[model samples]
Target: MALRFEELDFQPTPMGEISLRRRYDPAARQDVYEVRLGDEYLMSSLFTAAERALATLALDVLDAGPDTGPDAGLRVLVGGLGLGYTAHAALADPRVAALDVVEYSAPVLDWHRRELLPDTAGLATDPRCRLVQDDFFRRMGAAPQDRYDAILLDIDHTPDHVLHPSHAAFYTADGLRNAAEHLTPDGVFALWSDDPPEPVFEATLDEVFAERASHPVRFGNPITGGESANTVYVARGRAAR
Candidate 1:
């Protein structure tokens, strides 16, 4: 059996130290990519069901609308770029015309540009995708009104468990309201959570968006040989007064 070794690219950011690593798993017989913030494991290629679901579930609900057409030119904003799964999933849907991905880490963006990760699907060069080096929460707050048809967020661990202290506010009523301002009237906002459904967070979404849904995505945890689940929270933007 071959030993598992990781090729790491480390960088220092305002938030903290961010590391991108690629490792070969002898069990899976494939390469797995991972992202870490300091010593915290942020994301991994070994488990991406919920990450892909973040894009699929959001777009599926949006596509159900009567206003959506073959050439609707749907514009989407993805809040994270972990392995480009969300962005790649968004592009998989032909209805998506433009996708703007906001990632705070420059090295993560560079990994995609250099095609260092095992799966990029040409996300850096994709005609429909643009990778922006910016803070997702701040960008959402400052974006123009009705700027996006959908917003998919997966930056933090969860609504209650955030990587940065400043991000905690984004989960509150005021913060969500600010994020909602950037969405079209019928636009969708979907977020990925490491934890299961949280009712308190759901209530906040209801207060801000007026309508929301929670989907529990369950998948096999290869390392544990058991099932694990995550929550994908989707909400509709409230109409402007």
Candidate 2:
């Protein structure tokens, strides 16, 4: 029998202290995984609808255009590796040629590399995916030498509620424009938010991309036994250089 609770890994990072934990849920009758940054709960395996949607929705939009086909061979960049759900979902698509997952915390990468999460086992060894240790926001602000067909962000809670102050600029028009510059003209940029769709951020996306839309992903809350929702914002057709 699996232990009811266990802390897999814990370490102090420049951002703060982060930890990974596993617990057996009597109600769900399965093992649940969780990630935490200091006292804040970063993510849980129980609620991953939005994380998976962040990848599938972006890939759908990237492949929907007439310019793409079954053999699109798309390159993708994922800005977070929480539980590896988004990356796993992206890898399921045959069209993804390469996937670069940027995680600011090295301990988090080590967890996946060690296969701590059974659901995302083999993710690190997969030839199509690379777990990169770097600040995702910094990468977005850098040169666009390695443009991607799709860029998905799931690091922060929301535009208003960021885990770090440094991520505030990303919700602004200028910040979004910089992110757009790193995408192919027909490429897509997507974000996952714990909050409902924010008009201000959607408007910023509008300013940066020729097309933009927001989606609300609702799933049954394993803890609450009610539906919980998260927002996914997808933008395509970069408007500015």
Best by TM-score: 2
- Give each model's whole-structure lDDT: 0.86, 0.90
Q: How many residue pairs clash in each candidate?
A: 0, 0
Residue-level lDDT tens digits of model 1 in 164-202: 899999999889888888887888999999998998999
Model 2, position 11: C-alpha lDDT score: 96
Instruction: Write down the RMSD of all candidates, one decimal each.
Output: 2.6, 2.5
Q: Which regions of candidate 1 fall more than 4 Å away from where they truly are?
A: 1-3, 64-72, 143-146, 239-241
Error of 2 at 163 (Å): 0.9
Give me the overall lDDT of model 2: 0.90
Give candidate 1's error at residue 63 in angstroms: 3.4
Q: Write candidate 2's Cα lDDT for 1-61 as tens digits.
A: 9999999999999989999999999877899999999999999998888899999999997
